[model samples]
Target: MTTPVSLTIPTPAEAARWAPEQIVALAQANAAAARQLDALQLEFQAMKHQIEWFRRQLFGAKSEKRIVDASPHQMNLGELPVPESSPPPPAKDIAAHTRRARTTDYAAGDASALFFDEARVPVETIAVANPEIDGLTADQFEVIGEKVSHRLAQRPGSYVILKYVRPVIKRLDTQAISCPAAPEGVIRGSRADVSFVAGLITDKFCYHQPLYRQHQRLGDNGIKVSRPWLTQLTHGALSLLEPIFTAQLDSIRASRIKAMDETPIKAGRAGPGKMKGGYFWPVYGERDEICFAYHEGRSGKHIAQTLGTDPPPEGAVLLTDGYAAYERYAEKCGLTHAQCWAHSRRKFFDAQALEPERAGQALEMIGKLYAVEKHIREARLVGEARRAHRLAQAKPVLQQFFAWVDAQFESQGLLPSSPLTTAMAYVRERRAALEVYLSDPEVPIDTNHLERALRVVPMGRRNWLFCWTEVGAKYVGIAQSLIATCRLHDIDPYTYLVDVLQRIGQYPAANVAQLTPRLWKQHFAANPLRSDLFEISK
Candidate 1:
């Protein structure tokens, strides 16, 4: 069926009765509306271009180092010929002392040069007291002065206070789990504090220092432990905890909503420049628990294997940036892929950094989108409430915003070699993922939660440099995971590690959930300082 057009013009007879100017005015009005529509369309396109540029700079394939501005002093004046025949300036003449004015011009009558000499004398006094009396004796007074002089000895600098709280692990005489025996006289040792030993390996050896540094401290504190022995303990602890790590990975696979991100760690086994970097991929659940995986590579194949097969268990949504690997993994796993809008917005923002005018127009439009998100976030809406609110307030902005993107991308020479072109491409490619969050209450507006988590890698990187081996990198991943998890739970990492090392063996495996910072908070919430009861004896 053909639908009839909506608008109808007045009949010719009625049109003829109207003045000629009225007809012209009507035509002008229509032209003005068309012009306004065209302008709005251009503004939208510019916004999309700006947003896309930032996306590529951040999460897209276009990875290039941003050029830093040179300081004024750093600017070079082009090469110049050496100066020829420059002569040194002559010295200035000085007034002679004899010619200079003086106040003492009068001559005195000749008199013998007076000299006064007097005999010098020295006086000394001594204090005395009986040895058994309250008053000081001669010997006692000498002793007191000697002690005072010693105390008054000059020093170069004031002492500095070294504030460090020692770890508090009570010596519990306990039995360890029995395992198959090594050869005879192997000197089998039971590392009762396995978790702490893990921390020692991760925090000290793999990350900040070698095991010997820790061993030296132990020795200084009168604990006679060898570095080789500590290394053995670390290996043993990791071996014991491997199963728990595996179980945690299994738990992460069970989650419906997961956020995944990867960071590179230099694995020392790989040859210099030829070194293969390991990836710390954390797959976080919406619930209190998280699972971390350290993989040898950051390829799509690794991601697919880690996240599992296609047609992922029900309610699965994988959130990530515009990394193509993630897209492939999502496709292979049949998991719904959600791209970060922050990544999209960043594209434009980055372009704006280079091209201010185009970026300004783009930012104005994006600001509207953010304003709406900010409103919804401030309202603290979640689930259906959030989805409904976003659909109503934010959906139209997104539609208009994307439509603008489409028009810009279609135009020729509008993007070109400009980074804004890159930004535009990202929006067009991931438009569907960008919009999914508006429809689903569970989906976040962005993947910032996970990105923020990944920042720890860079922070710790600045301090400790790089991982020594694949095993060492894996240990770092484990420690960073626990420390980050503790931060998420609002627990002090040092205290948490110290407590775990001291009590983990006695802590029931079934109650491991309680050790998570969130749960630990509840147990100690009423009396947060309860852990302080176990302090190091001076």
Candidate 2:
């Protein structure tokens, strides 16, 4: 029913006569796809390597236990018996003993001659009244003049004792109502005397009473407060201070320049055989206004949301470690990134632990760069002065470092197992950011300020395990931010927390920003609105 199809075969000449335009277009398309695949493959490899390296660095390796089962032949160094030495002769009575019998004749015959010579001034004892001495003199006035008197001399390890000083409680008798349902013959303390009993809890037990173990102490004190109640109270106090915490965040956001970094925390109880990790990212802004945000996630989104939608001012910069997340966010926001040289140098330093001879040279070169920065920082150089100093002193060191790094790249293939190689790659990738501080006045040479702020997260993690919930995590962020900021300004955290908690609610919404740590410290320490709270300790 169907006609046989005509079978045809082209000759070599006909096949070679294909269109030149079509051949060129097809080749170009193939090349483009090959390039895309190659790029994707490279990215995937780099990311996989980085993740593997990070895992080793953070969790560390489970070291193999070397079992040396075979026992070696023992050679004993026998103990030599000590020969007993003869005892010395006994001392004779000085009053009845002859002068020649004594070994030291001067002590036997020269008792009267032992008096002071002309050079030895035994003259007189000078008595001075210490201004710091506590006591009253005549007329209820402190003594001011020196006089000779017998007094107990202070011995070694002695110090003036300071008694317990309690904060003065204020009572407000706005109104009163008599209660008719009072228990028979029962008496009660004033309600005004009640206060939030707050104390810092560390890994240590209170006089050897741990938190779970503290039940006995509470019961013995005739108080029936449960452990959970104490935990809730601590959280409640933190929640009450949240407004002041928000005020600090607002202030940090208002500044032109900001620095940020993160530290890890462990949540041992989050799941079975799994440790949940959280981050403490601290951001420091203008006037050294510091704030820490504890993030449960370590993605680039944290950076994006923390640093809002704008570039820091023209000369302003954000200092950070070589975290790619930071780099991505910084580029997106148009902020100049000032990379930390300490982090760069630290990588090489750790390399010394694994590969001493090879890492030594790289470390020496990195060390020179740090020496220059240390000189500038130690001179109290900041802003334009610091920038100028670093430029003059550090530029050459950095240039030398870069040249050496280039040499290493050409000569060395960094093994994934080597930490030095990882560090070198970090420095090599972040070369531009590392050099930014030399040119910009507002940029810092290190992210230490932010790092120092976030260290508490890890230190606290060793004790508290994980945050109980998201709300608990938020509470920690607020409390830690306020407490750490207070420390930054050299203000006592307890005093600052108390003052703010009592007055933050009363502060006008328009001026709530003034309650920020930096502002609050200045206001409360200098010209305080509440005179009773700010009185200097006597």
Candidate number with greatest TM-score: 2
* Clash tally for model 2: 0
Best by lDDT: 1
TM-score, one value per model: 0.58, 0.60
lDDT of each: 0.59, 0.58
Q: Give the per-residue lDDT of model 2 (tens digit) for 1-538.
A: 2222333444778648868885676577666666666666556556665775577578955332112235456433464454589587798876665556534222122122222221221112222223322253444332222222211111111111111122221112322222122111100221110022223221111121234544444344333446775565556566666777777877777676788887665533467766677766778886776666766779889876776675566655778888888888877877777889778877776565555666777767766766877787688777788887878878988888788777877885455556767777888888999998788766667887777777666666555656666566666677777767777788765455545655665678777666777888767756433212122212
Which regions in candidate 2 have their CA more than 4 angstroms from the true location? 1-222, 266-276, 412-418, 526-538
Candidate 1 segments exceeding 4 Å error: 1-240, 272-274, 502-538
What CA root-mean-square deviation does each model show from the true structure? 22.6, 19.2
